[model samples]
Target: MTDATLDRIAGALAGMVLGDALGVPGELWPREKVRSRFGRIEEFLDGPADNIVACYFKAGHYTDDSAQAFVVLEALLKAGTVPPAKTLADDLLEWVRSMNGFEINLLGPSSKASLLAWSKGEDAEAVTKLSLTNGAAMRIAPVGCLVEANEHEKLAETVARVSRVTHSTDVAISGAAMVAQAVASAVAGRSWDEIRTDIAAIHPIALVKGEPTWAASVLARLEAFEAMVEKLGDAPSEEDVSLLIYRAIGTGTMTSESVAAALAVALWCRDPWLAAVMCANMGGDTDTMGAMACAICGAKCGISGMDESVVKYLETTNGIDFRALAKRILEARANFTIGD
Candidate 1:
């Protein structure tokens, strides 16, 4: 692997963990409530008691978004490419059990249902998947890392195959596909100006690989993001910019909304730390958006864009060695080809 890619991969992992931990304190908060409570979350804070989801964890701890992303990364390292659906499912089930996800209610609606069905002996492909959540997109950055963006067919196939265990709907797959492509493109040193167009084009291409659905399209949401960015003009206040994305593109857990919001944040606020704080305060699905957005930002700029103290704390808290993980991923990726 190239030295530059190795650095970006480390940054992507750190950025992902950092964003997740930062957002945990106010997951699902209203923008106003977030502003009223914390002003601007420059550092990690414990989840407020009233936040049912965030309340389960303490300061600087990544939530299920990054956890599941690690699951996918582990699978990729083991498989040296795309693992089978059952392999990924089995690993995810282990994560749910080991993390006490059921008792803690850490699983998303789609993932929980699919995991429960799979645990109950339902075939992976047979699990009912009507929900169109960002569960897949949240954990899909590893696919981006392992597969280059030029191989969109392979990328789409791997994304669909792995995501089948949880979210297999068209909308869900479309969102996941775009994120994976974006991260891959960013890691490859492509500018967001170009990656934005790549992801928008990738939406329809990957959409066809999953079960047809009537949900809001990720493409439409991304298109909406363009107008929101344009309206921000040369210099909008942070409050105004945050509200624009919250109100226009949204920041919810839906595959369409959060996925697009993450892309917008990655484009609008290219700094990894800034993106994390912005997502944390933006409300809705803060952690997932932070994870996604920061993954892209970190991929583009590497760990150089992150605060050294924050990255160090994230590594120690999570027992994560981003450099080591990047090396392992590079080794695994070396074994993969678009044909595989």
Candidate 2:
């Protein structure tokens, strides 16, 4: 409710949009190709003519990552809080149908397959159980920032509810929960150390059946991220960071790689813009990783920390009101927590 808190919330949302747009041009490019094409990706650039997915969208345009996150935001606003599973599922089903018919852009495989199953009258939980991508994590920022700073428990609960709509696997939910908890802690003004602890401590829900094997797989990546960040030390050169992220940590869209990559970048960089830039340079799944890393860093830095020109360009090109959406989410959180 305080001005500082609002600033952090707005900054986090702005960071997602900025990261999404900035990472567009390099989405599926290899690190070498990205460097060869754009040098360092410090600003917005158009998608290359050859990329089928990226070419459909323009410079400064966000793909499914931001679009899906905005759906989560709209759902939250409509419910005035986190909606129940069926309600959220219906909203997502509608999104899937709408996008499938009218594809100016494309949807991620994890989300598309899951929603398609649901549309065919398959069990919702069964449909989601097959998803193990970072799709859920990419759209979870709003949930993380939709609660009071100290409501870490509520944050996790809301994450589970929304995640189950599309990502029911334990590993997918766990990755999403980690990001959400970090966002909640950051918006509450927690230090990086505290935020890391909060994220590391979260436990994934079973959600009917669990994916312990997958969960362990993702946990190994998370552990590797911690070890890599510690080994490289803070403020490593951009080239060093990019190499580690691409070669060792990886930049895939799977929850295991992308979640760990994003968290690693976030842990290594204190500045929001720097984190986004580093993720962008690392290439593959750049938009999702960039969005994830920057959301956490932006929560720490606040809106004032972002470059004015980049933020202005995102606003002008994307036509999104990040600050207004942030304010509404904060207000909804206040309403939900009034009795707590």
Candidate 3:
């Protein structure tokens, strides 16, 4: 693979970890609380002792978002593409098993529920029947980088195949597909307008009986992002931006909200570290939003744009070699060619 392509992949992965760690301490806090506690999260801070979920981890530690994405990365490296649903399901189940006693795992509701069903020997389809959460979109960075540019079908199918193992509902799958496509576009150096167009083109598919879809919600978030950005201007205060995102757009773990929040942050920050900082301070589901936004910005800017010390610190602390992961993904990328 070309060095440029590899750099983009590495940047995307490293950005994910950095964002996750940076946001760990601030997860779930409301904008008001976040502002009062830190003013603005300009650096990594340990999870506060009083916060229930945050206390499970320390500063500079990533939550299940990056951990699960790492699992997905390993699976993609082994399978060289989107693995079979059963195979992916097994892999995810094993991840839950490995984290059996570790409360820090912090698996999201959707993934936790689906894995619990799998552990009970339920069929995969049944396990995924009620999973309309952001869990699917949070861990789909590998698929984004591996999908060749302009290959929307490959992107969508790959996202669906992986997402269905944990999140089969229309909103989850659609959000995941949009994220993967946006990452692909970022890897190809597409403009924000092009990426936005790609995201807006996604169609939600209802796969299960009685499960509601978020097609309208997803579209509305997209428009909300555009409107918010137009009004916020290029240099809104961090407080103003955080409050707007939390109250106006919502920052919870829901796919319709968090994924769109990530996109909005990416468009506004346009830089990996800046995006990470902003999303970290925005509060609810901070790590996932930060990782998602930073991944996209990293794709646009490449790893060289990051601080060398911070990257090195993340690699040393997290025990993840993003460069090696990028290399493996590049190998997998070569095995599957997308047709124009």
Candidate 1, residues 27-58: lDDT per residue as tens digits? 98888888899988888999998888888888
Clashing pairs in 2: none
Candidate order, TM-score descending: 1, 3, 2
For model 1, state the Cα shift of residue 95 in Å.
1.2
Residues 1-340, candidate 2: write the lDDT tens digits: 4777888888888888777777888787788888898888887788888876677668888777878888887988887767776777677777766766235447777777666666676776666777778989999887778876556567666776778777878778888878877777889999999988878766443222344444445556767766775687766676777787788877888887898888878877877888888887888999899888888888888887788777788888888776777778777776663122
Off by over 4 Å in 3: 101-105, 203-216, 233-235, 337-340
lDDT of 2 at 164: 77
lDDT, candidates in the order shown: 0.85, 0.77, 0.78
Ten-residue region with minimum lDDT total, candidate 2? 204-213
Query: Which has the better lDDT: candidate 1, or candidate 3?
Result: 1
Model 2 residue runs over 4 Å out of place are 96-105, 204-211, 215-219, 233-235, 337-340
lDDT of 3 by residue, 113-223 (tens): 777767677875664656667898899877889888677767777777778878887778777777777777888878888877877765343122114654346557868
Looking at model 1, the pairs that clash are: none
Task: For candidate 3, give the lDDT.
Answer: 0.78
